[model samples]
Target: MVDRFVEGAEAHAMMDRLARKYLGSERFEWLMPGEERIAVIVRPTKVRHIVGVERFRPGGPVPAS
Candidate 1:
């Protein structure tokens, strides 16, 4: 839930899978969790609006009325 840390075999396996996908290697011992660095994940909880606008204009000059 909150302040959670990923540990153990399953989580490490996931990390290795993600590592293979991203770092092009499965044996990245350097990527292991340590005192200075730890695996952290953040997800979007809420989405309010996805807005867009469209305006069209002619390429050529506008004709006078």
Candidate 2:
């Protein structure tokens, strides 16, 4: 699994790259709420899946597991 923490334009660029490389002609589905900063989770399987996205709120406490 690969994870990336990105914000602003970098986040947009990363998503664009993933869409071009992995999603191809298919539409990408966002399974989580959009935020200014986020953690992208990439999982490997038969097909690579962008399985999870974690939103980060500034000044907010980290969520407990």
Best by TM-score: 1
How many clashes show up per model? 0, 0
Each prediction's RMSD to truth: 14.5, 16.0
Q: Candidate 2: worst 10 consecutive residues by lDDT?
A: 23-32
lDDT of 1 by residue, 14-51 (tens): 77776676667875466535524345555567756646
Q: Cα lDDT of all candidates, in order? A: 0.58, 0.59
Off by over 4 Å in 2: 1-4, 25-37, 40-65
Writing each residue's lDDT as its tens digit, candidate 2 over 1-65 gives: 66555667777666767665566633335635755645476766566446586546885545355
For residue 3, give model 2's deviation from the true position in Å. Answer: 9.6
Clashing pairs in 2: none
Q: What is the lDDT of residue 49 in candidate 1?
A: 65
Q: Please, what is the TM-score per model?
A: 0.42, 0.34
